[model samples]
Each structure stands twice: as structure tokens, then as C-alpha cells.
Target chain A: MDVTLAREWMRAAAGAIAADADLLTRLDAAIGDGDHGVNLNRGFTAVVAALEKTPPETVADVLIKAGTTLMSRVGGASGPIYGSALRAAGKALPPAAEVQPADLVAALHAGLEAVRKLGGAAPGDKTMVDAYGPAADAFEQAVAGGADLAGAAGAAARAAAAGAEATVPLQARKGRASYLGERSIGHQDPGATSTALIFQALADVS
Target chain B: MKKFINDPADVVAQSLAGLAAAHPELRVDTEEQYIVRADAPRAGKVGLVSGGGSGHEPLHGGFVGPGMLDAAVPGEVFTSPVPDQILAATKAVDGGAGVVHVVKNYTGDVMNFQLAAELAADEGISVETVLVDDDVAVEDSTWTAGRRGTGATLLVEKIAGARAEEGGKLAEVAAIGREVNAASGSFAYALTSGTTPAAGRPGFELPADEIEAGVGIHGEPGRRREKLRPAKELVRSALDAILDAKTFTGPVLLLVNGLGGTPLIELYLIYGEASAYLEERGVAIARQLVGNYVTSLDMAGMSLTLCQATDEMIRLWDAPVRTPGLRWGA
Candidate 1:
């Protein structure tokens, strides 16, 4: 991935989040606090503005800047969770302007680890981790199978979407929705849905 | 949705502006959205800081004053403060002595405060955190985040803030705060759900004859919804939930807190019922506070908080306090 692609990926994610903002919020209202869509939209908008104002040089710089912006702007668990994930992924990348697909796979693993570390969510906890974990795994597998950036991004995005859908029947085991106990079942996890959108944004840009 | 708000997006900022206008003793940083006592960071005193979502009025922000929080960080409505805001509040309140952060036990608040504490440590500031998880509505289990911090947050801030003001060390202040949290239990029920400015509608719906029992401050679902009962029965149910969790031996500090839409008359009535119920059980009430100290915006409900107070806690509770939402001896 290069700097331009990284910037495009963020722009795509912002557009997707804005487009699905209401849907995400409604989903959250069912089980969580009902602010997930609005919060993520606000954060991504700020990320776009920050990137446009003072552009970063390397792919890693782009991700790091976007992550820092989200951390500062998004005032919720998503801020620290998503923000640290992006920052850790950026840190895991090579310091050069461009990185190989294998390096991107490693960075994806790093981002997933960061999400797990911060939220203490494992797979099937019905959080963003559910989507993020599968997406990272799919991307790594695609890369190992000699898929190019576009092919790997497509695989990861599809995996994330499936992961989000799989949360519908599972009761939340973490975050605000966990407070609902059995009532949280049958609702799509908002955080996981948004994570899917973000991965789709990457695939679209790729 | 009929709030006196010009723009939903600006509720937090506008409210902070109003708070600053009303209380000149507070230094409200509109840009960073934090409130600090004008005389914060006293030369030899440990600073006390606490904060959460902005919808809970007079909570962390209103309680910022001489005998309360030295700094308060208010996030978006029902949202946790970002790490940057928390880090700034910590730095602003850090005296030569350490700082104590009294954090509510929500997932977002806990994670954000922990991140800020780590950042503050990297900057050479010593910080201690006291997590308040006193709400008994949500069961404490591995399947959930844990019991949420609710009305007892006010107790922790007041008691711990008093300790900090009395020149206690950071550890002492945090320990006192933790003790208060451990000794306290809260239960709430909502007649109606609160509307967030951005949502422009009630978070949840309640029928005319029904109530959301054990509702959270942010209108999160509670234990169950049940038919509305008389004030006495409601109070008894709340007490039963609390007493089931922990038994209070000594005189208790009782707080009948409204959820913004509740009036003083209703709160006093609930308090009276609670006082009578506890009196029947021979539980002594040493101190009591009533009103909308911590609230969800326009949610017509109330919560009862009982703190098993020690002699030192009672002494500190009677100490001077001057702030926007609460003031007495001073």
C-alpha cells in the first residue's frame, strides 16, 4: 500500500460511514447506546479534514495520522479501540513510502491484536473484534496464497461482512450491549457492522 | 424533543458555556471541554478529577469546586471522554502531589481513563484511579462489562474530594474513594426514557402504566420492565436490590437522586418512603441528599444510593463544599 491508496481508503471509509450512519445508529439503539453511527461519522469526517489540511508522506504516516485524529475526535470506546488499532497497524508497517502485501498482512494482524488488547474482546464476543479478527485472518490467507493487494482486500472485506452478519444471533458478551443480557440477541452488533464498512472501504479503494 | 437547544450538535459546548457564565469560580475550557477549579493544582494537595458523559448534569462538572473535583472532563452526551481530553484534565489538575481519577465503571470511561492515566504517567505525572461500580441493576458477571457506576459516583467524588482537600496523599484519597464505592449501592427505575439531543427522541419507550425497572442513567435497559407501583413499593424494591448485594452495618448516607425530569417534591417523597422503610428495619441514616445531582436528560426517574459510612466518611461529608450543584458548610 502507498500513501495515495491509504488516503483513498480513509476517504472511502468516511463516505461509507456517513452513508450508513442512520442504519448503524438504529442498530446500536437496539442493544447498545445508539451513538455508534454518529460518533464514527464524526470521527471519519475529522480524519478526512486533517488529512486534507496537512498530508502525510508515507502509508504508515497516513494511517497513524488518521488513527490519532479518530482517537482525539471520537469520544467513546470506539475512539481508543479503533484509534489504537490503526496506530498499531501503522507502527507495524515498514517506514518506507510503500509496503508489500505481506507487510500489510502483518500490519492487519497487529491492528487486530491492538483491538483485542484494548477492548479485551475475543472472537464471538459480538464486538468489533468479531469482524476485525476474521478480516485480518482472511487478508493474511489471501496474501499467503499469492493474491495481490486488490484480491486480498476483497477477501478481507467479504470476511468482515460475514463476521458482522454472524453477530445477529449471538448475545453480546462485552461493551454496552452486554448489559442487556439475553435481550441483546437478534440484534446486529453496531461496532462489527461499522468495522465491516471500514474493511469494504479498503477494498473499494484497492 | 422539546428542549431549549438551538443546535443539537452544540449541546455540550453550549451547556459548558452556560456553566462557565454561572460559575466564575470554574475555569471552563470550551475548546478542550473540561472544567477545572480556578485554584486547582494546589502546591501541596493531591488533585481529584472525575468525569463521564455530559447528560448526567451536575455530576463531574457541577461537583468541581473546593471540596470536590479539581478538574472535570465532560464528554459528549452518553459518551466517554476522549483520551486527549482526559490527559489534559489530568495534567491541569496534577499538583506537586499526585492526582486521583474517580472514574465511572462503564467500558468506555474505564478504557479512556486508563489510556489517559498511562499517557500522564509517560509525562511524569503520578495518577491513581478509583473505579465506581456501585449500581446493582446490572449483575456482576463474566458475561457483562460489570455493574455500572451510577449515583454513587457523587458520593465517591464528594468523600474522596474531601480527603484530597484535607491534604491526604494520592493513595489515601483513592483508597477512600474505593471504599465509598465498595460501601455504596444504587438502584433506579425510569418512568420514561431520556432523549439525547442528537437522537431527538427518547432512547427507549415506556408505556403509561409501566416503568423501566433498574434503568441505567443513560436509559440503558435494566433488569426488567414492570407495572408501575406506588412510591412505597418502588422504594422498597430498590432497597431490596441494594441490600441483597451488601449489608450496611453503620449509619448510612442516603441519596435520593433525580434523573433530571423528576421534581423536588417527588424526590422528597421517595426519600421519605425510603427513610421510613430503612427506619423500620432499624438502619440509621446519618446523612442525606436529595435532588437532581446526577441525571439523564429529562428522564423522569430517580435512583437511591446508600453508602455504609464510617466516622471518617461522616466527618469528611460534613466538611465545607462550594460548587455549582452542591454547596453547604462553606
Candidate 2:
């Protein structure tokens, strides 16, 4: 895959957020600041704009540029975390015009590690990591098992969705929900849902 | 429900137009959705970008002028702006020396800004991010999302932006922002939930005789709801919450702010109480800022932002600043 193809993935994610603004907003209302849809929409809209201005020649270039735009432009933790993820992923990628399934795994790993570093939190913390980490793992395992790129991406998306759903009962350790203490329990993790939405977008592109 | 808006969705966009029109010195991009300094893309200077949900008059947006923010992204009321607007702002502000993002610690706000920075980096614009988690109302144990980035965000924006404008590089600016967030704390008491124009009703209902402590700007419910106390008692409670935070033990810069609905007299009263309360604890006030710098929309409430000060902080606080709402040098 190239920059164009990856942005196609981003466009799909944008559509999901726009289509499910209510769902995303409701999820955020429960355990966040109630602006996931709006924020995501803003970030991805910037991504599209960047793409329109000058498309990246390499996959790494595309990912890094997209990540930076999100971090610089977006004004939330998600902006930095997701931005770092893509930048991390881009750094791990080879200077190739096209990407492979194995490349995708490396990208995911870099993205995950960047998030952990930036947020200073770990798994089971009721964050998007609940969804993103699992999908990254699942994608890596599938790719290592010799699964096709599209198939592994699809499996990753499914795993991510399931992981996001599983966050419903978790006590939040990140974001404003962390302020609610016990009140944060039983609410779905908005970050996880958005993470799942991201993987689902990847599947759409695949 | 009455607002001077053409449409709820277009409120931020149109208001940005008004911002540009009102101040020709600042470059407002209606298409890109940014309020950048007129001298923006300042060659080789580290750029500073700060934003949050709109409706907080003179906040992130109004604070964008010569000495503060290089650019400000305006989001919808109580909503984080989409990344595209942020990316545009970052690019517009980036003058080849990279950019720094000052993000409040709300989940959506943090996440979206991070994503924008990533996109910018891919385009070869180096980006660094610093999170502001200065609210003292939330418990600081490992189980929390950390602290809410409340009123102290104004302090960070002003100080960090000044440092960035003073030729501090991206890394240095980011470090100072983190340092500020570590040293600052805030707490808010809402006499009434904010009235959102789109929702028409209040964010939440507090009985006429009650107030909510630790209420955030976006209308999220606070830590506790209680019967309305006198201004002194309420200010004391707010001061205690902040003083009790892990990062608030040294000399401090105090920000006593009124929610949009509060009268100026009431704000002054709250400020007096806060000053006395802080002085009682031997917390020397290095600098004092009193006004409606950050606000919830039409909410009858106030917040106390206390930044534990270092000499560097005091110097930055006194730096020249110019904006539509705040001007020290003009």
C-alpha cells in the first residue's frame, strides 16, 4: 500500500465517525469529554486536507505527515497519541513506495509503543489501548502465520471491535473518566471505541 | 436560546470570520479554521498552538495574538475540533522551526491533537506535544486520568506561548509547558450548569440552592454537589482542593476567573476570598491574575487557577502579551 491507499483507510474512518456521531458522542459522554466524533472528524478532515495539498510519495512520509498534522492541529490527548502512533509507525517503515502486510505490523507496533510512551499508561487502563493493542497483536500474529494482508487486516479490525466492546465494564485510568472514580465504571471506553473504528477503517481500505 | 449565531454548526466558523474582521492584525482563516498571529510562520521561531472547545470567551482563541499563541483552533462548544483544522493551524504556524501543541487533558481533545501532530510530522514538520493536567479537584492516584486541565490552561498558554515567542525551540517550549502543568492546579465551583445554545437547556441541573464543586468548563458533572455556601467558604474549598494537590506546594501565581454568567462584582469578591485563603496557607503569591480569562458558557461559577511559581515562571508571566481580549504591551 502507498500514501493514497492509507488515506483511503483514513477516509473510511472519517465516514464511520461521521455516520456514528451519536454513538461516538454517547460513548464519550459516558467516560470522556463527549467530543470523540467531533475531534476525530476534525483530525481526519485535516488529514484529507494535507493529502489534497501534496500527497506523500512514500508510505512512511504519508504516515508521518498525517501523524504530525493530527498532533499539531488536534488539541486533545488522542491527537498526540494517535499522531505519535502514526509517526512511530512511519519511522519503523522502510523507504518504499509500497507497503506489505509485514510493514503494517511494524507500523502498528510502533504506533502502540508511541502511545504507551506519550500517555504514560499501560494495558487494562480503560483506554484505546484496550482496543488498539489487541488489534495490533492480532494483525501481527496473523501476518506471522502467513495470512494474506487483507485477511489479517480484517481479523485485526474484528479483534479491535471486540476489544472495544469489552471495555464497557472497565474502570477508566485515562482522561476525564479517571476523575469520576467509581462513577467511571460500567461505561464504555470512548478511546477503545474510536480505536476499533480506526481498525475498521483499515479493513475497509483492505 | 438566543445567540448571535447564524447556525449552530457554523457558529465557530462564522465567529472566526468575525475574529478576523475585528482584528486585522491577526490572520484568521475561515477556510483553514485558525487564528494565527499576523507575523505567523515566523521564520525559524518555534510556533505555539492552543485550542479547546469554544464558548470560553477570550480563552484559547482570544489569547492568540503577538505575545501568546501563534495560532488558536476554535472547536464547537464543548467539543474538540476535528484534526484538519488543527493540521492547518500547525502548518500555518510552523515556520520551519517545528511546532508545539498545548493540549488540555480531556480525552477527546488530547487524542485529536495528537493525531494532528502526527500528520504534520509526516509532512516534515516536527511537532512536540505537552499535556496540561492541572485540575486539583480529581484524585491524583494512579486510577485517575490524571488531573483535569482546567483554568490553569490559560496560564500555560500565556507563559508557554511567550517562551516560544521568545525564541525557545520546540523542545524547550514543550518542556516549559509540561513543567507548568506539573506546577499548576485548579478547582471550579459552578453555581449553575452552563447553558448550551444548541441544547437550550443547562448542561446539568443543580437545584437553585446548590452548587457543584470541581465542575469543568465543558459541562461535565463535577466531583461533588452541595448546598450553596458563602463566597468565602466556597473559595476556601477551592483553594484547599488546589493546595492539597501534589504539585502545588511552592510560590504560586493565582488566576481567579469568573464563568461567563457571573457579574464582575461577584468575581472580585471571589478573588478576595481566594487571595485571603491562599495567604492563610503561607503560599506566597508571586503574581496574581484576576478576571474572566477562561469561562464556561453562561454558567454562574468561578475557578481558581494556582500555578506554583519558579522565577522563570514569574518572568514569563510578566512578559508582554497582546490579544483581542488580553493586552499588556499594546
Candidate 3:
């Protein structure tokens, strides 16, 4: 993947977040704060604007800039979580302008690690980590099976959607939804849904 | 939905503008979205700064004045303030005696404040953080990553702010704030959900006769939904929750807080019920405060916070305080 593909992924993610913002908020209302969609929308919108103003030259540069923009622009729990993911992913890009499939796998692994670190959430916590974790594993599996970056991205997207769907039966063990205990079990986790969107956006762009 | 707002997107910014217009003693930084006492950075005095979402009106903002917060940062409605705004507030208020951040225990607020503290320290300023997590509704909730900091926030601010104003060291003031939090407990019930401006709707829908008991300041679901009971019953239930958490002996501070939409008359009725219950139980209500101190935006509810007060706490509570929402002695 090149810088152009990386930038396209971000743009697509922003568009996707904007399109499904209300759905995300409604999901959050059932379990967490009703601002996930709005907050993520605001952050991604800022990311797009920042990219438009000063487009980066490398995949690592684009990811770092996008991460920084999200952290400063989004003032919610999602901000730092997503921001840390992108920044950590950017750091894994191996000092190259173009990202190979192996590089992409490493990037996803780093991103997942960052989310887990920042949120203190494990896979069964019904957080964004649930979707991101599965997506990263799928991406790594696809690359190991000799797939291209686009093929890996498609696999990640499908895995993320499945992971998001899997959250419906979970009792939240972390974040704000943990307060609801058993009540949070029936609702799909909003962060997981949004993470699926991010992976899907990557597939669409890649 | 019938709110006095120009645009949902501009709610926080415009509200800060309105606050700046209404209170000259408080300085509002529209660009940074922080409020500071006009004469802040008092030499040799420890600075007190606290903040959270915009909907919790009198809370961080209204408390920014003499004998209270030196600065308060407001985020978007029901959202935690960004680190930049918090950093600015800390820098603006820091005197030679250092700064103490009174942070609520919500995940976003705690993380943002922690980031700001690291940044502030990098800029050569000393910072201390005191987490207020006194809500007894649940051990953890959706609005909180841990037990929430609720009505007791007001008590911590007033008591700690006074100690800071008296030239106490940052550690000393923070210790007092922690002690106050340790002795305090809160329980709230929501009659209506807080309406999000962007959505123009409440997160939860309740029938006329029902309410969410043990609700958080945000629109998070409470312990259980039940039929709206009489004031005496509700007050007694709230007090029982607190008493179950920690028994208060001797003098105590009772704050009957309105969650924005409740009227003063109704608050007093709740207060009367609570006061009578505590008195009958032989718990002295030494310091009483009633009104919208910590609130969820237009949520028709009330929270009761009781702090077991020591003589020092009572003296600090009665100290001179001048702010937009609270004033005494001075």
C-alpha cells in the first residue's frame, strides 16, 4: 500500500463514519453515552480536513497525522483509543514510503496492541478491541496465507463485521457500558460497530 | 428539544460566551473553552482547577471564583474536555504554590486530565490530581469507567478550594479533597433523560409514572426503573444507599442537588424529607446546601450527597466563597 491508498482509507473512514453516525449514536444510547457517532464523526472530519490542507507523502506520515488529529479533535474516550491505534500502527511502518503486506500486518498488530493498552480492555470486554482484535488477526492470517494487501483488507473487514455482531451476547466488563452489567448484554457494542466501519473503509479504499 | 440554543454544534461555545457575558469576575476563554477567575495566579496560593462536560452547569464553571476553583474547563455537552483546554486552564491558574486538579472519575475526564497534567509538568509546573468517585449507585457504570464522581464534586471543590486559597501546599489540599471524597456518598434518580442537543432528544424514554433510580449525571441507566414514589420514600431510599456504603456519625454535610430541571421548591421538599430522615436517625445535618450544584443537562432528577464533616471541613465549607453559582461569607 502506498500513501495514496492510506489517505484514501482515511477519507473513506471519515465518509463512512459520517454516513452511519446516527446509527452509532443510537447503539451507544442503548449501552454507553449517546455521543460515539458524533464524537467519532467530529474527529474523522477533522482528520479529513487536516489531510486536505497538508497531504502527507508516506503511509506512516498519513497515519501519524491522522492519529494526532483524532487525539486533539475528539474529546472523548474514543478519541484517545482510536488515536493511539493509528499512531502505534504508524510506528510499525518500517521507515518506508510504501507499505508491503507484511508491513500492513505488523501495523494492524501494533494498532490492536495500542487500543488494548489505552483502553485496558480485553477481547470479551465488548469494546472496539473486540472488532479490531479479530480484524487484525484476520489480516495477519490472510497475509501469512500469501494474500495481497487488498485481499487481507477484505478479510479483515469481514472479520470485523462478524466480531461486532458477536458483541450482542456479551456482558460488558470494561468502559462505561460495564455499569449496565447484565443490561448491556442485549445491545451491540457501539465501539465494535465503529471499528468494523474502519476496517470496511480500509477494504473499500485498498 | 425546546432549548435556547442557536445551533446544536455551537452549544458549548455559545454557552461559554453567555457565561463570560454574565460574569465579569470570571474570565472565559472562548478559543480554549476554559473559565478562570479574573484575578487568578494569585502569588503563593495553590491553584484549584476542575472541569467536565458543559451540561453540568454550576459545577466546574460556576465554582470558578474566590475560595473555589481558580479555573474551570468546559467540554462539549456531556463530553470530557480535551487536554489542550485543560492544559491552558492549568497554566493560566498556576501560582508558585502549584496546582491541584479536581477530576471526576469518568474515563475520558480522567485520561484527559492526566494528559494535561503530564503536559503541564513538562512546562515546569507542579500538578496534583484528586479523583472523586463517591457515587454509590453502582461500583461501575456507563458514564464512568469506575465508580463516578458525582454530587460530592461540589464538596471537594469548596473544601479543597478553600484550603488552596489559604496557602496550603498542593499535597495538603489534595489530601483534604481525598478525605472528603472518602467520607462522601451519593445516590440519584432521574425523572427524565438529558436531551442531547445534536440529537434533540433524550437518550431514554420513561412513562409519566416511572423513573430511573440510581442514575448517573450523564443519561446512563440507573440501578432499576421503578414507579415514581413519594418524596419521603425516594429521599429515604437515597439516604439508605449512602448509609449502607458508610455510616456517618456526628456532624455531616448534606447537599440536595437538582439535576438541572427540578425547581427549588421541589429540591427543598426533598431536602426536608432527607433532613427529617437523617435527624430521626440521629445524624446531625451540620451543613446543608440545596440547588443545582452538579447537574445533568435538563434531566429532571435530584442527587443527595452526604459528607461526614470534621471541624476543618465545616470551617472550610463556611469560608468566604464568591462565584457565579455559589457565594457565602464574602
Candidate 1 residue spans exceeding 4 A from truth: none
Model 2 / residue B230 / CA error / Å = 3.5
lDDT of 2 by residue, A124-180 (tens): 888889999999999999999999878888999999999988887777777766776
Q: Assess every candidate by TM-score.
A: 0.98, 0.73, 0.98
User: RMSD, each candidate, Å?
Assistant: 1.2, 5.6, 1.5
* Proportion of true contacts reproduced by candidate 1: 0.67
Question: What is candidate 3's lDDT per residue for A40-69, written digit by digit as tens?
Answer: 999999999999999988899899999989
Question: What is candidate 1's lDDT per residue for A136-205, written digit by digit as tens?
Answer: 9999999999999999999999999999999999988899888788888999999999999999999999
**DockQ ranking, high to low:** 1, 3, 2
Question: For each candidate, what is the lDDT?
Answer: 0.91, 0.81, 0.90
By summed lDDT, which 10 consecutive residues of candidate 3 chain A come out lowest?
Answer: A173-182
Give the residue spans of candidate 2 off by over 4 A.
Answer: A1-15, A41-75, A79-121, A136-158, A197-206, B1-3, B39-53, B65-133, B139-145, B156-183, B195-210, B246-253, B276-288, B307-322, B328-330
- Residue A34's C-alpha lDDT in candidate 2? 64
Q: Return the top candidate by lDDT.
A: 1
